[model samples]
Target: MGIQVWFIVLGVGAMTLIVWDGKRRRLKQRALSAAGISHNAHAAGSAPIPDLPFEAMLPPEADTPTATLPVNIECISGGSRIGSATHILGKVIADEPVLIKGRLEGTLIAPNHPVSVTASGHVASYIEGSCVDIDGYMVGTLKANTKATLLSRARLQGVVEAPRLECKAGAWLQIDVAQAASRQSVAMVS
Candidate 1:
């Protein structure tokens, strides 16, 4: 009976030691993580992340595409001044506002400018800008400075990459909304 009791006590003590060791290891890991110390020094030097603007995080290269310039359409003949009958059918590049009262069917690029597609506009191309306001219909990708906004009547079909987004009622966005909204909110403030 004495030997059996001793063996049980030893077993319990071993379990306690194991539990204590596990706790100690976890604490050590926490301390290391808090200090920003990586387990392997070599891995940190291989991949260097860039601090890119909110819109240019993807497509890898930070430079704008030099192969083609964006098309710019100021107005369409016979189209309503407020955008009654216009159709944009090619790439657009500009440093000014593009008020559309017609249709756009190409890519729109504004590296350092903002683009606003009014409620009467219908866009079917990718949009890259410092700021994008969509109150119309967009069927392509949208990348804006920290945020992309969809007014009440705005409709989107393709991917949206913005650190922030604002989607009012009746706005139709197919991708993630929460993250986009957060990004946009941050962009607006900063």
Candidate 2:
């Protein structure tokens, strides 16, 4: 009888711990959501959050075409990021990798590093990088020195110039393929 009682107690304790941990996680998730930090895994398949005023997150030099912004201050993991709530209308030049989760309407130049656009990102401008990966919506011209990849959820219109181009199964592309010949000559030479 004592052994049965101990087992019951242990089961109850485990259940209590599980409940408490679930509540704790809920509270933490609520706190993070209120603070504009979202967990990507938890927010998957949900409707996009409304745009917030994220202009203050931009570097002061973002509007200046000639200015080079430092990577360390704006980077999230050695790469620069444009948050989901931000929208910029000018040029962006980065020496390091760039991840876009917002809206950009001008030029993005990262000639030596990769540039990625997430599923929530919208870019209607020119993108130049070493490698470009798009999982969102983009219209205009994209130039990548090495490769350009359009993911399953990506939608692209206009032109793409890359030595290697990959379009996933579900991606939508309406491009002008005639002007995408810049790297073909170089590829043949090498």
Candidate 3:
């Protein structure tokens, strides 16, 4: 039988021929593990990252590092969120630490700070920050000024630009490394 015949016999959802044997059950687990979304855990509750104003997430410019404005930046805890069905639309900027466990669709700018996307978090936006840690489903651009780390259960898809990108053993990254060659000395231009 041809491929079309098999599809008709089974279903369109069964794209891969697993042979229904014990040898291929592990492949299904690998696919689930990479996305960072656990199929066995579900207890609805509050949101992960609260809905804040666009200006609230912005970092105050200062003459030197370790200095910030008098803006009251709230810190969110991971335990408070339980993968709630909340969706945010717009740009989110933060100067303090951020932990996302819900769905966000927009640009998230948190420079000079740490941004953590948990396994339950699903971000469909551009994320720019100092140190980015992903352990969930992310489908967008990730630009890290310092470093970007993908945990063992992270699943990212899109262009990722950074000086350093580290992926764990079980992390899944569908990306290609790109090096910047625009850093030239002043004397070279002269």
Give the worst 10-residue stretch by lDDT in candidate 1. 40-49
Ordered list by lDDT, greatest first? 2, 3, 1
Give the per-residue lDDT digits (tens) of candidate 1, residues 1-190. Answer: 6999999999999999999999997885576456453222111112221222213322233253334232233432332233557554556786654456566655677756667777667765467777677877766567786667777556565556777776665565544323434522111101
Q: Rank the candidates by TM-score, best first.
A: 2, 3, 1
Off by over 4 Å in 1: 1-82, 176-190
Question: lDDT at 134 for candidate 2?
Answer: 86
Name model 3 segments beyond 4 Å from true: 1-83, 182-190
Candidates 1 and 2 compared by lDDT, better number: 2
Best by TM-score: 2
lDDT of 3 at 180: 66
Runs off by more than 4 Å, candidate 2: 1-76, 178-190
Q: What lDDT tens digits, residue by residue, belong to model 2 across residues 133-175?
A: 9878876677788899887666776567777887765566656
Tens-digit lDDT track for model 3 on 1-190?
9988987877744643555544465764565456553323111221122233323332334354332222221235432232447765556778676777787666678888877787677776477889888877776567788999877556665556678877765556554444364321111000
Residue pairs clashing in model 3 are 57-93, 57-94
Go through the candidates in order and give each one's C-alpha lDDT: 0.56, 0.67, 0.59
Residue 180 CA error for candidate 1 (Å)? 11
Worst 10 residues of 3 by lDDT: 181-190
Question: Against the hidden reference, what TM-scores do the models get?
Answer: 0.48, 0.55, 0.52
